[model samples]
Target: MKIAIFDISNYHYTYLYSQCKIFENDRVDFYVSKFLKKSMEKEGVLNNSNFNWIVLNDFDNKYKYYKKVIKTLNNKKYDYVFFNTLQENWLLNFYFFITVNKNIKINLTLHNINIFIKCSRKLKIKRLLRTIIRRIAFYRANSYNVYGENLKIYLEKYLMKKNINKPITGIPFSIYENIKCLNDMNNKIKIIIPGTFDLKRRNYYDIYNLLKNIKNFKFELILLGRVKKDFEEEILLEKFKKFKEVILFEEYVSEEVFDEYMRKADILLAPIIKQIEMDGVLEEYGITKETGVSFAAIRYSLPVILPKEIKVMKEIEKIALVYENFEDLIRIVTKLFDDKALIQKYTEKAKKISYTYTPLKQREKLFNELKLGR
Candidate 1:
């Protein structure tokens, strides 16, 4: 089958790259931003004859770029067209909804459930128009996908309200490429948090408190992602600096460095906030969205520490170390320090769970869910 995957924002190029590899037997065309192309090329995931990388400039006019995307899809006559994301791209989405052929399968991956479901209730014209376009594009799609089954139910309920009965599939987010999970038996158990240090998305103050309490234990904290610009948490940084074992990155972290740190760490600490307000919509992390750190845990086969409010899929439930509060997290961490065997045990269990999300296994699941024959 011929497949075409598009990610004009370049935010989801890793996902597109993974899809290309999953569908290696088929003729795949990946339409990505030039930055994504360069990133993939640097990562060496683009060297393939069966795959075509169509670079789209980030500075190009949105109208022209999306027009070319539609024209190329129609010209190539792809069997499947996948949109890695459709959030805030209502114009391009409306274009595809009205212009694309209905015979071709149109698939969309919902990165954020609340963004599509909970629109602003304000009487503003701009917000109302955007919501309408988004809903039309969403309803027009043949199928939809989410990162996990835990969130799929919420999406199904949303679609049901719209009276649109379409297939909603769950595909585990793909893991990092060519990396092995290593169980490091070190004196200081490295706890790594893998996303931007934004208080809005994650509870950094909780991390600060957790750090203060855990100083007596033999553990290190690694902040793996970049700090958000104009961050008001400079005082938090100062507080974190007081800890000798804490590692922080004030600037952008490259892919290589990020992967290296992930491989080196013993635990994936995700302090995701339960409730986050995005674009005037309230989103509950476990119910309305899945955390990227959970996939990071799957990728590196590291046991993840998450808040109890955030629920992981059944597949990784065993690998997740969920804590209800600061004391609970401290208890879990203290146990890991005292019983080194638990770390290795979770590592082994997580490794087995990681196998369930391998590219081959995920490809099979995707085919089965979409009824695409092997």
Candidate 2:
């Protein structure tokens, strides 16, 4: 079958394209919308003929963008067109479906349904428009895919409200199947948090204080990803610099550097306090209803620390340590550091769970659902 995967977000196209290429026998054509051209250009060569992938960075107008793209691809006779919908842009996804020629099968990969719901609820005008768009999109989708089971449940509830019959499946994100585990275990514990350094999502100040208080353990905290040019970065840098063990890489690190930190760290901290639904000062911590960083930690065999109230986190409790406050976090980390047996147990459980979402397995399931041969 001739397949064309359209990655609207563009950030995930690299990983998505890699998965689609596993079926060498099937002719797969990949296209990324020009949303991240600057990022892609910085990374170097964009096209790989071996993978049958092309980066198209130009579109004439918003109204005719999908139509023209579909018309051009129709001439090549694509059997399936996979549209990767963004978490925050349901209306745009639905608009594309409505305007485009709908001869081909349409499948949507839902990254974050919670974000969509929360955003719609906050904005009255957007809520009404999005509701209509969602109803139409849900009705048209042949198959719906989600990253987590929680999202699958939400999608089903939404579909029921719209009186639409559709199949929503839990198709988790793909990770490298044969990832090499780090063998060199040392006495000093290294903690790394690799993600967007938004002050709202990550309580970096609280984390800094927690680490500072626990001086007995030889622990090093590494913060990766780019920090926005704001007062928050300046304040964080000033405060964290006093601690000799804390290392800050305040720029966008390469994939290799990010993976290096992941492998080196004894534990990955995803201490996202549930602050989105909270009141006043607490809301400053940017913990939203939908956060994807936990998936990354899970994929890397990192024991994630989260708040107890997060319902979606309950599934991975075996590999997670739930804590409500800084005291809870310090206690858990101290206990784990002192007990080698407990550390091994959690590490093994995390690795075992991570193996379940390997790229090869995910690809097989995705292809089978799409009715494409192995």
- Tens digits of per-residue lDDT, candidate 1, 198-292, equal 87788888888887777778778999888887557676777888889889998888878888888888988898888887666777777777788
lDDT of 2: 0.63
TM-score of 2: 0.80
Q: How close to the true structure is residue 66 of candidate 2, measured as C-alpha lDDT? A: 53
- Stretches > 4 Å off in candidate 2: 13-18, 21-25, 33-50, 58-67, 73-79, 86-95, 115-139, 275-290, 312-315, 367-374
Candidate 1, poorest ten consecutive residues by summed lDDT: 174-183
**C-alpha TM-scores of all predictions:** 0.94, 0.80
How displaced is residue 162 in candidate 1, in Å?
A: 4.5
Quote the lDDT for 170 in model 2: 47
Error of 2 at 126 (Å): 8.0
Model 2: lDDT of residue 231: 93
**On a 0 to 100 scale, what is the lDDT of residue 19 in model 1?**
75
Which clashing pairs does model 2 show? 200-286
Task: Go through the candidates in order and give the C-alpha RMSD of each one to the true structure.
Answer: 1.9, 4.6
Give RMSD (Å) of candidate 1 vs. truth.
1.9
